[model samples]
Target: MSATEIPEPQVWLDERGRPCPLPVIAMAKAAKSAHGSPVIAVLADDPGARYDIPAWCRMIGATYLGEISVPDDKGGSAYVVQISESAQTDASKSIG
Candidate 1:
């Protein structure tokens, strides 16, 4: 999707300095808590995020809206995600 088409993040999860899978987990938690299809921005500096975030999004059926540069001394990157409505429903579904 085009950058202009992506909506601004409704929730920002700062996972900078955190390790690979942790950021992904944080994103999952954020998506689980949020309602509807909200845009979420995850700030992370770990190199793994470049691959992991998009992979996680795809695995969860969420839309990976691409990464944006974050202007800060830390020089962290902002990975954007569009949480699909089905994602929340799937998360709420109980395992049998």
Candidate 2:
């Protein structure tokens, strides 16, 4: 879906200033505890997140909604992900 069409994120992960892989790792943990949030927005300043976030989403079957640029004070933008219903079902099945 378009960035504008995507819903506001229920889970917000702030990983600004952290290094590569850390942001993605935090995002993964946050996503796991999201409890079916439609969207999870991760604020990361790490350049690797520009690629890792989307890659992680693909690996987990989540939809990479888009990235939203934060103000200069925030350091960088946020990568928004939409956790698909199918993905949630799959996760639940795996846990059960």
Candidate 3:
């Protein structure tokens, strides 16, 4: 998929107002439980997440689809990640 293409997230994680690490931690957990979903979207306000989530994806071999702005009422933006079937397998193996 193109860098600008963001799939509809099969799993949505709302981590707005949560501190650093928490957003990424919740994202990892959500991703682990996604059951082969193509995309997982994490809603977070933490400035750190703008970097941390992508970094986590890199470390885990998942595709960081990039972030999209959320409505002000919902918070700042949502971080989108694409997990390939192979990446899911890799992640599961690593987690287990």
**TM-score for each predicted model, relative to the true structure:** 0.86, 0.80, 0.81
Best by TM-score: 1
> Judged by lDDT, which candidate is best?
1
Q: All models: lDDT?
A: 0.84, 0.77, 0.79
Q: How many residue-pair clashes does candidate 1 contain?
A: 0
Instruction: Quote the positional error of residue 7 for candidate 1 in Å.
Output: 1.8
lDDT of 2 by residue, 1-96 (tens): 566776778777889989988888777666655675468888988888999988878877888989876635867878998887666665455445
Per-residue alpha-carbon lDDT of model 3 for 8-86, expressed as tens digits? 6777788898988998888766666777656888898888999998898888888898776663576568889988766
Compose the digit string of candidate 1's lDDT tens values, residues 26-52: 888888889889999999989999999
- Using TM-score, rank the candidates from best to worst: 1, 3, 2
Q: Using lDDT as the measure, what is the rank order of every candidate, best first? A: 1, 3, 2
Clash pairs, candidate 2, are none
Give me the displacement of residue 49 in model 2, in angstroms.
0.3
Clashes of each: 0, 0, 0
Pairs of residues at least 3 apart in sequence or in different chains that clash in candidate 3: none
